[model samples]
Target: MNPRVIGTVRSHLVSRDQCPKYGDTSMPPVWIELAPDFEPAATDLQVGDAILVLTWMHKGDQAVLRCHPQGNRKLPMRGIFSTRSPDRPTPIGLHAVRILGREGLRLKVHPLEVIDGTPVIDIKPDNATLQGTAEFSSLVNPDTGQAILSAARDGWLRGLFAGFNGNVSMRQGERVVITATGSAKGHLGPRDLAVVDLATGTPLTSVRASSELAVHLEVYRNQPLARAIVHTHPPKLLALSLRGEGPLLDLPLFEGRVFADKLTRVPAHRPGTPELGQAVGVASRDFEAVFMDNHGLVCRGETMTQALGLSEELESLAGIAMRR
Candidate 1:
């Protein structure tokens, strides 16, 4: 069978380093330029979607490999594959990054950790294991029994909602309730928010219950580690969705850090319905944020702080893209 090569990636050289210390060293942000033929596949990638990034080890110094893999100045070395050392026989590195969004031939990805101008050899979808880990479990909020609420309420959430013009809410156990009083952009005061229990699919009594209450309920129900959920209508994100843009191009922005592991993008669905909730649940199975095409954005964090931060970052990114 022929090995399929789907996309070609190109990044410029920035610097050279050894072992785990490679990502730690300073280097310019390498812009990843994908081949034009890959645009269709590239645009189709969504938040939380994982891709295998292959890069030519241009800066690889063979002599460096003979030294300690850790380059600790004391410890002896092992084979390259044994220690994830960049100095390998093939002089190639494979990194897994989350797709943040795209601009023309450039893709913004998260967790790149590679130096700027690194030559990218190829790009492929990452289809690996589907299992939870203690890493995610550690983010859960023990006091509130919510995973991401604390992080969401912290500066992260505030940043996400900064200048946000939409309704916001919080979920208590099985009940979804309104927590914020805000008007939609260009709309009048006191917009109503509604929430519905996922188990019963019944509306709860709250003046500002979230319209997409089911979506939140689904996250809480599906992901044991999830605690807080956020929904908003950032103009650029909504505009891209309306334009039939499937997912924002991946960029290595700060928001990517908070949401690196669990970002997902859901196709647009009618707002305030069980279908919307189910769609969100599916998209968020392995992601933190899900882009709802033609509608808005939905994100679940182990803490509200994390969720909030991601929300704000998403909006800011959208704004940045719009300005560009």
Candidate 2:
């Protein structure tokens, strides 16, 4: 069966080898050249939005069912289904990219690692996962929303979030105001925050809670000291994880070596998965700061401001330690 191509990827990358295993901040902006027939679909998309781009990797080997992960021969061979290997019976490429700009029939997105000329099957808004939305309230808290908006602005200013990539949650008694899923972290307001019950991870606000809500709830249940949580994509900290120095950042700098705690590096897990959330929740029980391998950072604090500060401090320490 032939799937109609709705769009095409126009990226600088020519092959899978040139792209990172996981697309991140380092990737160049890529354009989705939609066919004029499909231009109407562009009306719903906007700049600063995160959309899931489904594509057909025309260059992959569909006949090869199993291989080493990421072309590394040393790693044991595994079925293609277990890994995100593009080579499979159906070589569909999935990318969660942030919209940078929109034109009549074109959209510029970031962190899309597919090669140029790849066929795009479809695009859809990734506002929030429906896995846990049934328990949330549709109403929002004006006060909590305002505070998180301020914090999200600070995160954007510090380059901790690439678009609406990161999330923040502030606990108020038994409830927490979490940044709503898929909302722009830089422009968050009360409307963009979800009030949730810490015990059940159920949202009391109308907007759905962030995809990482499970981990946030786990922190509250496991760590009494964790009154607030800040999850951000600090480039330096992410880089450290990529280089294998994140688990023990024993840098030469006095402050870097002595002040920071040993970061807990959680193994790579599919983001937003229950397993991933459980791993983070378990890790946060012992470590105040956790680094998600190949992904981002999770920091807890006694207050919202303190949690925000931990994100900045973690980035600073990562920068200093790596420089030494």
Candidate 3:
């Protein structure tokens, strides 16, 4: 049975050739105007909600059964079904997205790699990965993504991160933008940061973002006041966290109150899991900076500069603790 066209993409592209390959993370979010017939199906959906989008790759050459992956001529040809190539017997485009905004039947979603005039086969709520959706990576706008990279490099130079460890993020509307996983933090560039829907974790881009993304998302959801976050595995902080009430807390001074007042320690929870995210969220509700037992620390602020400064100041305190 053929799928009914429930929606159409409204875009500025004048031709299919103008579209990028599927899952192009760099593409910006666009609008999907659903038909009046499918409007009732959108019940319970709201802004920031994650959805599974099914689109008919109308521009694809369905007759071609085999092709190189991503249209790369250097790769060996494979069956169309074996790769994500949009050209296939039934070019159904599958995408995980979050609702950015909605007005009547028109809705906006990010990085949906299809071109204008494409037929949308269906749209379903992304329930399975919804809880983990924020972990999915999306693209940060070029200018902003690049600016965050400079801070990331500074984080490395200042020893907030070592090797490929640590993560950084800034929230923008319905999504959270973060550093990519496994990329060298010491020498990061603009393309290093990715975006994911804040509520659903739907990756807005094709890049693989850091797994610790949940930590960032949880903080954003719990504290709308927080716009930026910095996470680091400082050796001194980790060492002190292992011992309850370390010198960082016992120091009798005004600096101690500024640094340790309302500080929270998340009970040991495995990193990169929803449980750990919940733990951080709970701790963050009352504290600007938190120490994860036997793990690391998370610092948040209204801006990246504040978060970065807090991270740096805490390091100094942790160093003092280590010396005592």
Best by lDDT: 3
| Model 3 C-alpha lDDT per residue in residues 1-324, reported as the tens digit of each score | 468999898766657677776556667788999889877787545566567899998877789899988788999999888888877898899987777778888999876877788889888866554234223222343344555676688888988888988888888767777888987888876556677889998887666779899899899999988898888887777777667664455666578678878467777888899999999987888899988886788999998888888888887787786677
Judged by TM-score relative to the true structure, which candidate is superior, 1 or 3? Answer: 3
Per-residue lDDT tens digits for candidate 1, residues 1-324, read: 223344434334345442236453243333477666767766544333456788765566555545565667578766666766666656677786655555677776655665565667677766441233221111111233222233323433344334433444445444444432443322222223333454675653334444555677777777766666767666666765565544474455665444434456776688878898888887777787888777777776766667676777776666765555
lDDT of 2 by residue, 1-324 (tens): 547899999989887778777777876798999999876667646555557899998888889989999889999999999988888899888887767777778899888888889999999765443234321122222344455777889988998998878898877657777888898988764456676777777765467889888778877887889877889989987777677643546666666654466357788888888777888888888888888877788888887787888788779887876777
Full candidate order by lDDT, most accurate first = 3, 2, 1
Pairs that collide, model 2: 137-205, 137-206, 138-206, 139-206, 145-190
Q: What is residue 204's positional error in candidate 1, in angstroms? A: 5.5
Q: Which segments of candidate 2 are over 4 A away from where they belong?
A: 1-143, 245-248
Position 135, candidate 2: lDDT: 19
**Each prediction's Cα lDDT score?**
0.56, 0.77, 0.78
For each candidate, give its TM-score against the true structure: 0.42, 0.54, 0.58
Worst 10 residues of 2 by lDDT: 133-142
Off by over 4 Å in 1: 1-165, 179-198, 201-208, 242-246, 252-262
Q: Residue 262 deviation, candidate 1, in Å? A: 4.1
Clashes of 3: 5
lDDT of 2: 0.77
The stretch of ten residues in a row with the least summed lDDT in candidate 3 is: 130-139
Residue pairs of candidate 3 with colliding backbone atoms: 133-200, 133-201, 134-201, 138-195, 138-205
